[model samples]
Target: MRYNKEDLIEWIIRERQPGGQMFERFTERARKVIVQAQEEARKLNQNYIGTEHLLLGLI
Candidate 1:
């Protein structure tokens, strides 16, 4: 279940396609948050990114 950057971008596009430009904007924000979470996890010596991290970003 390894996800690359393009995979994430595609997922975001698909998830927000219905909302058009607004959804696109949201997706961009979400992606930034996800990246930040990944960086923070790395800083904490985490080997994998988990659902909890993603959930935290969403919140």
Candidate 2:
């Protein structure tokens, strides 16, 4: 897993962006974790702050 966005950004920064493919690798539960992580990274979308319900639903 990536430590921070700087790491993610540095890793993803490229001449041609084939993005969003990263998310495709996630299972439903794993995807939820990633979505929550991404929201926390942005400091936006407070809905992801309380994402346990998503975990419960997915599981």
Candidate 3:
């Protein structure tokens, strides 16, 4: 399976809708990094995120 930017963005939007409690405790900066990580994963054409993606997000 491959991932594109649109699909990843849609997934993020859907996950942020009401009833999503997973990120409730996360700081705004943390959330931004996660979104960036997803973008990194999409850029690599990956269906899932890895440590490299998170590192890139931090960078």
| Candidate maximizing TM-score | 3
Off by over 4 Å in 3: 1-13, 16-21
**TM-score attained by model 2:** 0.35
What candidate 2 gets wrong by more than 4 Å, as runs, is 1-19, 44-59
lDDT of each residue in 1-59, candidate 2, tens digit only: 53897876776774222325666666766767665555563465454435654444344
lDDT order of candidates, best first?
A: 3, 1, 2
Candidate 3 local lDDT, 1-59, one digit each (tens): 88999999988987765334566688888877777888899898997869999899899
Segments of candidate 1 deviating more than 4 angstroms: 1-26, 55-59
Which of 1 and 2 is the better model by TM-score?
1
**Residue 16 C-alpha lDDT in model 1:** 49
Cα RMSD (angstroms) for every candidate in the order listed: 9.8, 8.8, 9.3
**Which of 2 and 3 is the better model by TM-score?**
3
- Using all chains and alpha carbons, the TM-scores for the candidates as numbered come to 0.42, 0.35, 0.64
Candidate 3 RMSD to the real structure:
9.3
